[model samples]
Target: MDFQLTDDQRALKAGVRELLAARFGRERLRAAVDEGPRLDRALWRELGEAGFFALRLPEAEGGVGLGLPEAVLAFEEAGRVLLPGPLIATHLAAGVVDGAATGETVVTAVDGGGLVEWLAEADVVRGEATGAEPLRSVDPLTPLHRVPVSGGAGLADVRPMGSTGALPTAPLTSLFTAAEQLGTAARACETAVQHARTREQFGQPIGAFQAVKHLCAQMLVRVELARAAVYAAAVTADPVDIAAARLLADEAAVRGARDCLQVHGGMGFTWESDVHLCLKRAWTRTQRTGSATESEELLAADLVSGVGR
Candidate 1:
């Protein structure tokens, strides 16, 4: 089947990209990272006004009534710009909130699968009241706190991670995260290619070297492969398909960042370079909804068993 993006999809991508380029530029992203775990309230409000957070909700719910595919396009652009914050959680919570359509409310995810501690930033937190527990997150951008719940029949309680089964939201969130990674990977590839073409060494362009060419080609392959899987998952909306998408996307993110760094050589390792930032974000996001290994194992099991359900 043809997998080309429709005209509307292309328009959506272009719109989001332009918005991000204007509002969430590289300087703003670096400032947010430097400032610690706090989100850019002004940027968030701007995004809200632009309907970035309310794209998935129904029109009656005060949203633009866009579907997941559109959400994926917007999120892909967000990833390319390394837009920080718990974007997926915020958007998902917005869908569940009462007056989120008009961008009147804010929402965040509850840690430990407990009572979602809708912080000062959130007008409401969506989750079971008892499932809340206080927890700290490694990524400063995603503020972490507890959700207090008595107990439940699931995984560990100390740092109760939300299972894909316990919270049906995991799959969708994972897919969105994957889509973001795909975007990042693609951008990273572009950065690497551009650098190789411009950076001269030994009286020749670095891109002319066999090693650099191979790296760039490999990055392209990873990005395209991941894009295919992500697009398939976005179109199908099947949990199993999402498993594969997550695997490919995570691989692309991880490898693309590394390859881009390699192409940039020493410069890629510096703080000023955006490659490391992309790498860090990719590493953090890969572990968000679930581990890459877990996703791979799940996909492998399904393939081996010929499971089509």
Candidate 2:
């Protein structure tokens, strides 16, 4: 089968990228960081107006009438900029919560266990919410609160977003999460290469160094491989496919960021540099929806006995 993106898909990706570049520039991101973890109502509304949070909702529901592939591209842009907040949760909350599609209401989620993000600030929550308190998050861009489980379920106040039975959301989460990882990984590679080209050592550009070349090449390889898996998962959106995609993406984002930091040498770790933020965000994303271990386990189960369903 042809792997090329259709014209519309390419347009969607470009549009999202342009929108993010215009809406969430580096200075704005730093400003947002200074303000801390509260929701950015203006940015959120801009996303809504842009049909970002409602990409997958049926047009009948006043959404964009797009599918997972489109949603993945949009989320890839968000990831590239490291846009904060409960993006996936709010997008998934579209139909279940009135005004969520329009960004008029803010929603957060309690994932299967004690992991609930933005619980304190959400206008509405979905899942079983119970004892909730803020937990310091590694990615300051993402404000999170973990809710203690009660009777085997975590705390959330909104009704379960199921008509009769809940639709499986793992694949959606995994695909979108992987897309985010792909974006971050690409950014890390770009940042490292750009720095290597300009930052000179002993009168020669650092990029001319054999070691730096290898590092940048490896970063590109990881980013491309992860992009392939993420795009494939966006196409299929199968659980096993998503699991595999998430696994590759987790490694690409986390490892790519670390490698980028190494290329930037001492300055990468400073607060003024975005390199550290990428690493932290990648680390944070590795545990969301499914981590490396979780994804590996799922893929292994499916490979060994076709057990994961």
Candidate 3:
């Protein structure tokens, strides 16, 4: 299968990136950080107008009528900017929930671990989030609520393309989560490289140092590998492939952010720097949908059963 993106796909990805940069630039991101937990309804509506949530919906239903690959591309851009809110949930809810396609309705769901993100702000909660206790999230941008873990009944809105798990929701959720992870990983790599070229130490750029070079190189390798896995999984839509993509993407995001931080040295630890935010968001995203352990378990099971073949 050809891995190269078509012209239209490239255009779509670039358009989303440009839109996000214009709307949620660094200044706006910092402002959002200072403002506390609140969704920018206007920005959300603009994304809706851009067909962000309705990317995969059928044209007959007033959608962009694209496939999962296109949606993944769009979401990768979203992750790059660390766009907050229940993006994946709202996108999944586009056709099912009223006004979701238009970004007028917010939707959230209880994860397998019984956590709901942006629950209070949601116009529709996909799973049972009853008796949820708010948790002080590590990522300030993401406010979280926890419910007691139980055998979660599947939500009606989950449109399963081909899920390997007993619950049909994992395929799209895992794939899209991986796509977001890929974005963060790519952004972290870029940030590290940019800083390495400019920031100096010992009268020369730090990127000249072997340690910094190795870190940035490792980040790039991880990002590329994860990107390939994510794009491939988007095309294949196989459970095992998606599981592998999630595993790789999660590692790339978390580890790449850490490596990026390492390159920034003391500045990365400061609150004013966006580097820390990327790390925190990457950590938080790891817990969403299919966690690393869950993906590993699914892969192990597939290997033992030869189900992937």
Candidate 4:
């Protein structure tokens, strides 16, 4: 299949990028990191106004009537900017309630793993099971609580963090998360490459060094490979494909952050540097929504059983 984005998708990415560059710039992002666990509400509302929260909903639901492809593009931009929030949950809710297009509602999911704390932000929380209780969230920007449920309630509560549940909407959310990871990995790679090219060592550009060059090249490879998987999974909407995408995207996110840090050397480790933030965000996100190990195991089981084929 031709993987090229259409003119519309390109425009969508550009628009979102421009908006984030202006509104969610580094200063705002730092403030959120220092003072809040998630992103700023005003900025999120602005995104909502931009129809980002409603892009995947049907026209009848007051959405742009787009599909996962469009949603992925928007989310990729979100990842690029490290735009925070229970974004996946909100979008999943939008898909279910059919009201996200207008930003009038908030929806989140519950899984077998635990109850998510951020459900407090939702107008409605959906899940197969419930194990919820009120709890304080480390990320001040998102309000989280706990809930308790029996059997496969699909949601659970883990303090300082959010709950995890088997989302009825897991496939789509997984694909979306993969897209976000792809964006993060891509941005980290870009940042690393830019730094390497400009930062000199031993009277030569660091990027000219074989080790630095190799690291950047590897980061690019992971990002591109994961991007392909993520886009394929988004288009196909297959569980196996989605799992594959998640696995690849997780690797990209984790590895890309590490490689970016390596390229930056000591500077990457500093609090002022964005590399650590990227790493922390990627690490946190990978575990949530779903576990990387779980996805890999599922993929392995599918492959062994000839299911993924």
Model 2 quality (TM-score): 0.93
lDDT of 1 by residue, 171-231 (tens): 7777888999999999899999999999999999999999999999999999899888888
Scored by lDDT, the top model is: 3
Q: Tens digit of lDDT per residue, candidate 3, span 158-225? A: 45532122325657887899999999999999999999999999999999999899999999999999
| Model 4 global lDDT (CA atoms, 0 to 1) | 0.74
- Please give the clash total of every predicted structure, in order: 13, 6, 0, 31
The per-model lDDT (C-alpha) reads 0.75, 0.82, 0.88, 0.74
Predicted structure 2: clash tally: 6
lDDT of 2 by residue, 1-309 (tens): 989789999999999889889988898889988988788888888888899878877787788888778888888889999888788888887877887888888887776545777777788887766667777888878776676656325322334433311436555666788989899999999999999999999999999999999999999999888888888887876778888899988889999999999999999979999998899888877767676777889888888875655
lDDT of 4 by residue, 1-309 (tens): 678888998999899999999998889878877875543456656777898877766677666777778888888888888777777777665545555444556556664355463565666676643446755653344455544645335533311111112324656666777888898899999999999999998999999999899999999999999988888877877778888888888899889999999899999988889888778767756755556887888788887895545
- Give residue 204's error in model 4 in angstroms: 1.1
For residue 239, model 2's alpha carbon misses the true position, in angstroms, by: 0.5
Q: Which residue pairs of candidate 2 clash? A: 128-154, 128-155, 128-156, 129-155, 129-156, 130-155
The TM-score leader among the candidates is 3
Q: Candidate 2 at residue 54, lDDT?
A: 80
Q: With candidate 3 superimposed using the best TM-score fit, by how many Å does residue 109's alpha carbon deviate from the native? A: 1.1
Candidate 1: 10-residue stretch with minimal lDDT:
156-165
TM-score for each model = 0.84, 0.93, 0.95, 0.85
